[model samples]
Target: AVLTKGVTPINFKPEFADADAAEGEDTDPHAFQSVANAKIYVKNIADAFCTADAEGCDTYKANAAVYTEKLDALEGDVRTAIQSVPQEKRVVITSHDAFGYFEKAYGLTFLAPEGVSTESEPSAADVAKLVSQVKQDKAAAVFVENIVNARLIEQIASETGVKVGGTLYSDALSQPDGPASSYIDLMHNNIAQIKGAILGS
Candidate 1:
């Protein structure tokens, strides 16, 4: 409808669907994983909106550009913080798998007992295997995600004698007043936590 109407409409995640419901539907979308991805989303939204609504095209483009600049700055800060950790000590274990983008962007190695998504838990045997790997690798730290229960990570920490590094913002953004309200803030908070844990800050 946007293309035909020449006006952009906002899309909200299913998690945010309640907010949409207050307005009306339930949805559980989890597309935005990082600030970089958010920036791309913003650009795409703006372009689509502009193409649909010529009257507000300039405004959309300008706002996207401004927001994208902030995302770039946030990326720089994350890079700087992650770089503070020694490359050899950059390996980290998390309770669930959600750091592929983070690992690719920053120079960290991630190990997870759970598969790529956090929807399911790993088996006891799988956890035991990962525990052994953690010990063999001497991973700098083990982390839990805000969205996942920490019991599994705690057990792994106990078995491996590695302290729980800190919470990593995985599937969702924190509340607006929290440390990870935005995608950039999320990455910055995560990198800072990882560095502090691994580097003894």
Candidate 2:
């Protein structure tokens, strides 16, 4: 019953100990957003489920540990890849505002035509304003998100005379066989794309 945006669904029914309690179901549903969040979710789920389903507690804990290790390794790879980019050219523009966690984690500066949420299209004025900002900022590249329409970014690139950088995966994971199915792969692909564009520019 727990739900999270951009996370694969947990494919099981959760049973609470206090079934008849008046309060709503308690869960930290968006648990896969970060390693820390995943850790918390595993702890909470284990405590709750261990009481109800003792036989499966150890298995769940083991799986969580394996996944956590992978996440940690992915974080390291992201750090190294982003660090490979020159510090002076670290800023870039994208079509949507979906990179706050990435910016915080990977030391990237992301400018977007839209605001923090991609719930609506950017107004014409908004696009023009961002174009001006990109030129003023001397952004290294103009990138489009895989999930967003690229026309605005193309327009911005044309206006600024900067090349279309590359497609970045945002919000949703790519297909399992693609370059960005996992968070680590997404970060690596993005950094490589950005670095290539900026260095080539």
Residue range 1-201, candidate 1, lDDT tens digits: 222232222244332233235544332223344456667677878888888899999999999999889988887888788778888898888754466556655678877643222344657786787688788877989898897777777777888877677778877889999999977778778888888888877
Shift of residue 114 alpha carbon in model 1, Å: 7.1
Identify the runs in model 2 with alpha carbons over 4 angstroms from their true place. 1-52, 114-129
- TM per prediction: 0.74, 0.67
Over 1-201, each residue of candidate 2 has an lDDT whose tens digit, in order, gives 232333433211122213212234243232343444444555666566667788988887787678678767766766776787788778888765455556655677876553322334557776677678887887988898887677777777887877687878766778999888986677667767887787773
lDDT of 1: 0.70
RMSD to the true structure for each prediction, in A, is 8.0, 9.9
| Global fold similarity of model 2 (TM-score) | 0.67
